[model samples]
Target: MMDTWLTNGKDEGADGGSPTVFIVDDDCSVRTALDCLLRSVGVRVRSFGSPDEFLKSKIPDEVPGCIVLDVRFPGQSGFHLQNEINRMEFPIPIVFLTGYADTRMTVKAMKAGAIDFLNKPFREEDMLDAIAQAINCHRARLSTAKNVKRVRARYDLLTPREREVFAYVATGMLNKQIAEELDISEYTVKIHRKNAMEKMEAANIVDLIRQATTLGLAVHAAQPEGMANGTANGASNRDKPSSAVSNGTEYDCTFE
Candidate 1:
């Protein structure tokens, strides 16, 4: 788990919420030059002389950013640092900077998900271009993570009966079919479905399905005739999202 001192107890940027470029290199000259160049273009930056220092210091995970990591260090290699950061909950994209270049090293880094690999004496244009691409990707990843969290929160807000109706309806069950399976009236099924849709903030059936997919909720495939004959059981656990909160019984969380 990374520390959080940079946040100063606020979500918005400790660095003005701007995308940052983190520089980790042993050479003082290298770190200073890169900082000046990046700051000149209105980019946020933080520099460290070694991998341990970088890992020890806190960075605001919410900041959209990339790392410019030196490929070779005295004790810990850049690859080692890369692997460590990749295991983090919110890993920053890495743009590798190496004074020495080789085909095998380049392939390995790219395979491990580095955004860019630049040889020493790299052009300013190339460096800036790589950093831009990395920041764009990191921003997109953060957006997706936020969306999933929001969907999960809404799912947790649903009543148990509403969640059951949601699973069935999302898989294309009619209110009548859902009512039959759950031992409720079609009118009641309709009510639950309506409430589920509202709580999930879905615009329509299509939108509702998308949100269900995002939730990773278990939904049996639609089989209307079999379901009417009471052949199908409840949803299976094969694809359930780990974060979803569920009750043991259908009426466990129903409200008056």
Candidate 2:
């Protein structure tokens, strides 16, 4: 039996998105004071009296945001809620607030991936700083996710054989070795590898490996001998320069 309150307003951050600060505390007065303070700074906020009520809210997946959580509640502790959120793989950063602070609890909160843990009656500047840091962290995470998605979309444009070749190449396999493994000629392997590189817009083996790692693809420890010897289809170690976009920036593969 908890109440939920949402304060809506517009305040663009450096990234052009109005980030939200979610406040979950059992105390009504604490929630009100926080709401007023945050709104004064033009920050959007949503307050909940319990974790369950907060979880039931329809938070957008792409929103850059953070959570301010209290340490204790009637049924579930903040630590328990943190664990649940981690299990659910939600990307929002968390800042913990507590009246009873101890060394063990602080260590536990930090180890659990909390952005900050502040004792009750903390300084306003400290709270604001923690919230800003958390929002920045969340935004960075969202940007990375978007970049990964774009890379994955480019990967989807490759042919099936090219994808298989990409996997082998990313794992440090040479052209001849990939040919033998796939029961294809070395020339065919080379062609597919080139196609994959072009489609993925990978600058070199290093860049390809980075994208593959981001995609959670398994890679080998050894480097590709062909790339090391500069025999990768006579392609240079450096990536080829790309054409300019309408914005006058080079069309690099990096989403950042």
Candidate 3:
């Protein structure tokens, strides 16, 4: 008996984005069938007969997509290829198709982050559902990555003193505490903190902390005793001139 599965289709082109489905199968018939099936439902399809050919193809980072990979291949197994792709940080979600339904292989693939696994002669609807899930997952990941890049860019605009202030603020430090730690005037600390918040487009200290954590900048929040003291001395000797501030008053930051 064939295992059957079904899932609702998402709104086609909902975000004005075209997502591709990549099929890497050794069997020509399987490739053709998958290509036809995906294309019929408005998905862009790319098929390759071997893992080598798929690796050679240039897939753009901006394209929201997923991979439909066969488990067993001639040169390199799908599992090995998946590991290599993950090591390279390609960010494409994978759906595995295999003729031999080995329990151990399925567990490994799923543990390694495969979006879905199916045996040979799987239901067409089930494959479509897996493809849809994979594409959505890929799109969500790309969105997060883009957001991180934007946040990082804003972070880069901060002056050295402002950056220090931001780290202190993210760690729940008050203006007075930050001033004492940095050995600066309370007024100066407030000025730097305000500037950093504006540049980061944080709504409040809580929001700022969230963004910092997302960008993996939270580690800087916990300043070492020696480093904090050193920075305090350095800050004392610095000129009092304020850094130039960007005129923007609002930033559109989305978090899920």
Clash counts for all predictions: 1, 0, 0
Q: Which of the predicted structures, 1 or 2, would earn the higher TM-score when compared with the native?
A: 1
lDDT of each: 0.76, 0.74, 0.73
Ranking by lDDT: 1, 2, 3
TM-score of each: 0.77, 0.73, 0.77
Q: What lDDT score goes with residue 205 in model 3?
A: 80
Better of 1 and 3 by lDDT: 1
Clashes of 1: 1
**Alpha carbon lDDT at 172, candidate 2:** 69
C-alpha lDDT (0 to 100) for residue 170 of candidate 1: 72
Best by lDDT: 1
Q: Tens digit of lDDT per residue, candidate 2, span 1-256?
A: 0001122443232245467889999999889988998878777889999998888888766677888999999977998878877664335778999999899998998877789999888788888888877776766666666667778787789898987888878776779978987999999999999899899999999998777766666655643665664346776343221221121111121111
Give one digit per residue, the lDDT tens place, for model 1 in 1-256.
0112223322252235767789999999999989998877767789999999999999887777889999999966999999998887667888999989899999999878888899888888888888877776666666666677788889889998888889887766668877888999999998899999999999998888888876766544545554553344764322322335332111111111
lDDT at 76, model 2: 78
What are the C-alpha RMSDs, in order, of all predicted structures?
A: 9.6, 9.8, 9.0
After superposition, which runs of candidate 2 have C-alpha atoms over 4 Å from their true positions? 1-17, 157-160, 171-174, 203-206, 218-256
RMSD of 2: 9.8
Name the runs in model 1 displaced over 4 angstroms: 1-16, 218-256
